[model samples]
Target: MTIPNLENNRVKLSLLDLSNYTHLESIAQQKDLIYYSPSDISTPEALKAYVQTAVDGYYHKNTIPFIVFDKISKNYAGSTRYGLISWKDKVLHIGWTWIGYEFQGIGLNTNMKFLMLQYAFETLEFEKVEFRIDDRNQKSRKAVEKLGATLEGVLRSDKLMKDGYRRNTCCYGILKAEWPEVKEKLLAVIG
Candidate 1:
């Protein structure tokens, strides 16, 4: 489970593991971001399990997760990942993203996404990158759309939330052909 460290002028994406639980827990408590996720990481034990699941996913080839770091502030902002990867299809899903409330509205998300898209499209040569948002998460839906991802459709009852309710997922995608334009747009916004 060697997750590469990704960086740019504004932020860094470090490989997340059990060792990062304390930092992640600190950020998790200071923000409401984790409320939307299926994992309950509010406590030390829960955070450990949450990270272990992600680590397991990495070993299973189901995901590669990263801890979002703000380079300028030198603080942990949140987390994001490349999940549901299909090497044969040259496609990967990017979701489970969250930025601490204090860091939201800044350019961290754009910079992080930019680095990821660059890696997925240029380095890995993925043909398409997908994003799935809970239908009720308007903030997430807007953020994905802002990245120039086209709305594909909805997956009814796609996931079970921590609240014991099924969540409808809104699917979005950005093809390699659309990367150049999206990249340009992101650069402008990130700047």
Candidate 2:
């Protein structure tokens, strides 16, 4: 099932592909854009490979990746995705989100996430959505927490990072039942 473009006045997310490499090139090279993760998109080749992996996952129906466009700034931002999809279990993870330095703290991310969460709970009929964050990434952990996702638990030394470090993963989740309240809060902020 193909995911259509998810858009609002704040941000637009289109299915990510190789062609998106150009749109993202302008914002992908900033220092530590995604230093917590293993994937590196600092160079042209690395960025292409990164997008290619996401595209391949889409072909395999394993993830729905997106290239972010900040409509307010009128500029391409970065990327995110709905990953680790389990159709039978009706659960998926939302993480791997990164934006340019200029895009940070702009509320674009909250708007974008609100749209995705609404779609996942209402349209896709998913039972739950999860987020895995590096424990040290307080910025992201707090962001997701603000979205009303509960801190479920932590997986210590769960993931390998580019810096040859094994990072602790903090698991957060939003049950479908919790979406109504979360949506209300997000709407108030978005408006």
Task: Report per-prediction Cα RMSD to one decimal.
Answer: 1.5, 0.8
After superposing candidate 2 on the true structure, give the runs of residues whose Cα lies further than 4 Å from its correct spot: none
lDDT of 1 by residue, 1-191 (tens): 45568998899998788887468777666545666667776777877787788789888888898999999889998888899999899999997787778889887888899999999999989999999888988988898899899999999998899889998989999999999999999888887
Instruction: Give the Cα-based TM-score of candidate 2 against the true structure.
Output: 0.98
Off by over 4 Å in 1: 1-3
Question: TM per model?
Answer: 0.94, 0.98
lDDT of 2 by residue, 29-60 (tens): 89889988878999988989988888898888
The Cα local distance difference test for each model comes to: 0.86, 0.91
**Strongest candidate by TM-score:** 2
Clashing pairs in 2: none
